[model samples]
Target chain A: MEKKDTFIKAIQENERLIFKVASFYTDSKDDRDDLVQDIIYNLWKSFDTFQQRSSFSTWMYRVAMNVAILHLKQRKRKVPAVPIDLGALNFAETGFDGNEEKLQVLRKLMNDLNLFDKGILMLYLEDKSHTEIAEIIGISKSNVGTKLSRIKQKLRQQVNNQNQKTAWN
Target chain B: MELDELKSNWENSNNRPANQNSLTAKMIDQMIQTKYDAKLNKIRYPEIGGGLVCAIAIVFIACNFNQLDTAVTRSTGAIAILLLILLPILSFLSLSKLNFESAVSESHVQVLQQFAIDRLRFQRYQKMNVTLCYLLMVAIIILLPKFFYGKDLVINKAFWTFAFSFGYIFLLVFSRLMSRYYGRSLNQAEELIREIKETTANS
Candidate 1:
């Protein structure tokens, strides 16, 4: 197959996964779009070195996740606060279908986590195996489990606190 | 929501449009080109700034070349002329080595580590450039009078001595201040590297 044909096919097959990864790393639609473009750019650059050691989807996960994390770090260095239009987020479809409220609250919860925990939570939410998450994130499997458990606990506490505030209000 | 419930929502969320129309191959190629262009332009800006300063110094020296008479004045003029040629050439050579193309195949940790190293290298080069220019200015100021007015120097030896002393003190203090500023950036890069290592390490 031609390179462009294969590249487009791969991206078409994995756009949703890539979109989720980019959205997890960036809060604003503009930033998310930039991150996605960067991920695609990096993927195309590294495609020749894919070597097919793992499944193509797995390779996509590795490349997309790494690009997202690097983008996040560079943005953090450039601007401490990511300028996000809360309303603009409402326009972009997160692929969550009818669960817009859930997605919003989840994004809020994610904002409370540090960069490392955010990666763990993103991978965990994808239902990836601990070993797979570890490989993608370059951390130990046990560390992934430990961090995921802690992240879940943190999310539960935040939800509970929100519920308390609603009841009081 | 609970963890299990969130997983179900996430898995169900994969029903995005299955077309690859958003970012085309042409767009990707453009992004790659823009990325390198931006990198090269970064190095070019500094080179241009250094070149301008060099040009101005050469013009100033050329207009004042007739003042050299004694051996002391002649040697000072020669040193000034040498620096007028040397500074920009050295800056361009060092900056040429720093046009490193970032590889997309590298891992996140590898990329971050390389970024920290490259940034530190660039910052150090900037610090050195600033210091060298300041010292060169001081040297010229101290020597220029001896070339242009050697007779006045004998009558006002104390005044020239005082000016040189003040200039050296200013150079020392200003260079320290500049180093501190650059040092903070280097420290920030080092801290970032440490954070990446800690997060990625198996332990």
Candidate 2:
């Protein structure tokens, strides 16, 4: 009972992170809900084995990312869904509200990244440090730095291309 | 919007999409219960069916033990009892080793690795189990003649030939199906593991 209470408390604290993961992986509300539920169940099931080697949120991200990726992989066989790549989006200098168009663009960008990169990007978006991202995804800190640089470059290129198109018009 | 500007909006966007629904403990519990019931259904039907078959076989053999009063018959009954205990234990061990539930807590790569290892172990266990069953069947066939050593047991050659042919064909097909099933699963696991390795590997 005590353990269950602890697990619930941890989840309550980090519910937003769980929601972020589910939203990143899935497009539809139904899918997102299912992903969140699945992640929670998994967290509950393995609550005992979580020895706090890392922070609970970090561990939760690890678990959530795994479940989401696997779920996406399996679902891919049945329905075709776009991968989002944030690198390709043109963020307005004055960012748009979390409007429908912005959300759609964000979703598409998320779809384009592979699972590992997706994990890194999710952490990056959350303002997590390179070291923390590396620790969560089991990658080296240097690699995380390199990947983030490359990703930023990609985003820059996309933004430049969009600018060129607007100038031409 | 600039990436940095997007970050501010993201943080200010109330943590998620506007329509995002809040989840409660009750809702989560319901979802967990649904998943648990589904998993239970997956294991329950096959396991219970297998258990029932084994129970019936053991009971039938025990009831007929007195009718066939021979050292060979007694040994056959002993073998039946052994199988009644051994086969289920083997099945249970194989099933228990698979941690589908725990995969949720592991990282993607770690889960794939663990699942691949568990699957390979299970496939090997299943193959050994099939071989043991075939050997036991052959042993029973060979020992039946011994049970009829002092008595005159009439058997038709044609019936024996047909029975052996049918049994062999069935065993061959069953073995092939099992091989194919395990082979496909192993391939999938291997591919997933390789993909994860590649994704995480430093360039």
Q: Which has the greatest TM-score?
A: 1
TM-score of chain B of each: 0.61, 0.59
Chain A TM-scores of all predicted models: 0.78, 0.79
Error (Å) of candidate 2 at residue B171 is 35
Q: What are the DockQ scores of the candidates, in order? A: 0.23, 0.17
User: Candidate 2 i-RMS (Å)?
Assistant: 8.0
**Candidate 2 vs. true structure, TM-score:** 0.54
Candidate 2 per-residue lDDT, tens place, B1-203, comes to 45565566566554353332244455556655666665455544555677787787678666656656556557766776676667766776765543556666665556555655666666777877776677567545644554445331224576468758977997899889888978876676565466556656753
Model number with the top DockQ: 1
Sorted into a CAPRI-style docking class, model 1 comes out as incorrect
Give the top-scoring candidate (lDDT).
Answer: 1
- Model 2 residue B186 CA deviation in Å: 18
